[model samples]
Target chain A: AQSVSQHNHHVILSEAASLELGCNYSYGGTVNLFWYVQYPGQHLQLLLKYFSGDPLVKGIKGFEAEFIKSKFSFNLRKPSVQWSDTAEYFCAVNAYDYKLSFGAGTTVTVRA
Target chain B: DVKVTQSSRYLVKRTGEKVFLECVQDMDHENMFWYRQDPGLGLRLIYFSYDVKMKEKGDIPEGYSVSREKKERFSLILESASTNQTSMYLCASSSRTGPNSPLHFGNGTRLTVT
Candidate 1:
């Protein structure tokens, strides 16, 4: 079974600080990676996705993720985060199946 | 914009009572999914439907059932609600165009079983 592992359970950072949330998946085959964000009192929304081509994918809200096949990792990164970026971030992986397996999620709290 | 709407934002059900969590998608998506989100457990897939009236059991489908009579609607049913089943239920719909398509999520229905 394919499973996703997010290294950070909870992260706190000051405004304008660089951020990185580690994500690793267990699938050995071709996998599609995604970063989804759930803002306060809002539904979960897709930030970005990587299917093919570029391993480094840029997403909305100044977020980006690098997909490293050798490491089985798709780590989310932001050069500078804002207070508004506080939310629960989830890393999900789809291995060409109809279902997606998600990580335990990382709660990012950006302090201003 | 793609929207997936759950029937309820919060639900309270008694043990041994049958519970239904409804989901509707407006994008005419071919895939509808039911997931339970719990602390420390993330999102666990309960069931999914790829087409109308067609369903597939996901990772955690033991105590849950699903109905999909229409293309835009997928319903999750709990034959007998249990306290262990108390969690936020999220409904999502996606296109079956290989893997690039992301899942559009509903606001989620938080169910509490007593």
Candidate 2:
């Protein structure tokens, strides 16, 4: 079974601080990676996704993720985070299937 | 933009009662999914439908069933609601064209079983 692992369960930092969230998946075949964010009382939205080509994938709100296939990792990063970036982030992996397996999630609390 | 709509934002049901959660997508997406979200558990897939009247078991489909009679609508059914089933239910839809087509999520339905 394919499983995604998020290294941090919770993250806390101040506004403008650099942020990085580690994600690792157990799939050994062709895989797609994604990061989804859920704000308070809001629906889950796509943060970014990595399909093929460039390992560095960038998405809305200045969020970027690097797909390191050899490491089986797709780590999300931001040069600076704002208070609005505070939310629950989920790492998902789809491997040779239409369905995706998500990690346990990481709650990021950004202090204003 | 694709829009996924979940019928209810909140629902409360008693144990042993039948529960129905409806979801609809405006786009003609070929894939629809049902997921349950809990604190720290992220989202666990319960069921998914690729086409009309076609359903597939997800990672955790033990006590749930799904119906996709139409391309735009997908319903999740609980034969007998259990307390453990109390969680936020999220519906999502994605196109079948590319792997990069991200899933558009609904606002989610918070279901509480007593």
Candidate 3:
């Protein structure tokens, strides 16, 4: 069974602070990775996705993720986060299937 | 824009009652999914349909069933709702045209069983 692990349960930061949320997945085969964000009272939206080619993928809202196959990690990062970036972040992995396995999620609180 | 609309934003039902949650996608997507979102548990897949009249059980399908009578609609059914089944349900859809298509989600339906 494939599972995703998000290391950060909760993170609090001031505005303009650099952010990084760790994500790791357990899959041996070819995998597709995605980062999804859900704002307060809003539906989950795709932040970024990595299927093939570039390991470093840039997403919306100045967010990016690096997929390291050796580490089995795809960590989400932002150089400077804004107050509006406060949301729950989830990492999902699809290993040759229609179903995606999602991490527990990280709650981010950016203070102004 | 791709739109996935869930029938209800909120629902309340009694234990032993059957619950139906409807979802419709406008993109004519070939894949539809039902997931439950909880605080600690991010999103657990309950059921998915790859085509009309074709359904597959997901990780947590013990208490859930799905129906896909049409290409744009997927329905999740709970035979007997329980208090523990109270949670936010999200419906999503994606194109099977590509192997890595991202899922478009609905606003979600928060169901409470008492």
Each candidate's interface RMSD (Å, one decimal) is: 0.9, 1.1, 0.9
Error of 1 at A9 (Å): 0.4
lDDT of each residue in A1-112, candidate 3, tens digit only: 7999999999999999999999999989999999999999999999999999999999999999999999999999999999999999999999787788899999999999
Backbone clash pairs for candidate 1 read: none
Query: How do the residues B3-96 of candidate 1 rate in per-residue lDDT, one tens digit apiece?
Result: 9999999999999999999999999999999999998889999999999999999999999999999999999999999999999999999998
A-chain TM-score, model 2: 0.98
lDDT for position B28 in model 1: 95
Q: For model 2, which pairs clash?
A: none
Order of the predicted models by DockQ, top scorer first: 1, 2, 3
The alpha-carbon RMSD values of the candidates against the true structure, listed in the order shown, are 0.7, 0.8, 0.7
Predicted structure 3: lDDT = 0.96
Write down the worst ten-residue block by lDDT for model 2 chain A. Answer: A93-102
Candidate 2 residue spans exceeding 4 A from truth: none
Writing each residue's lDDT as its tens digit, candidate 2 over B72-113 gives 999999999999999999999999987667899999999999
Across A21-102, the per-residue lDDT of candidate 2 in tens digits comes to: 9999997889989999999989999988888899999999999999998999999999999999999999998877679889
- The residue-level lDDT of candidate 1 at A39 comes to 97
Model 3 misplaced regions, further than 4 Å? none
Q: Could you give candidate 3's per-residue lDDT for residues B8-91 as a string of tens digits? A: 999999999999999999998999999999998999999998999999989999988999999999999999999999999999
Top-down lDDT ranking: 3, 1, 2
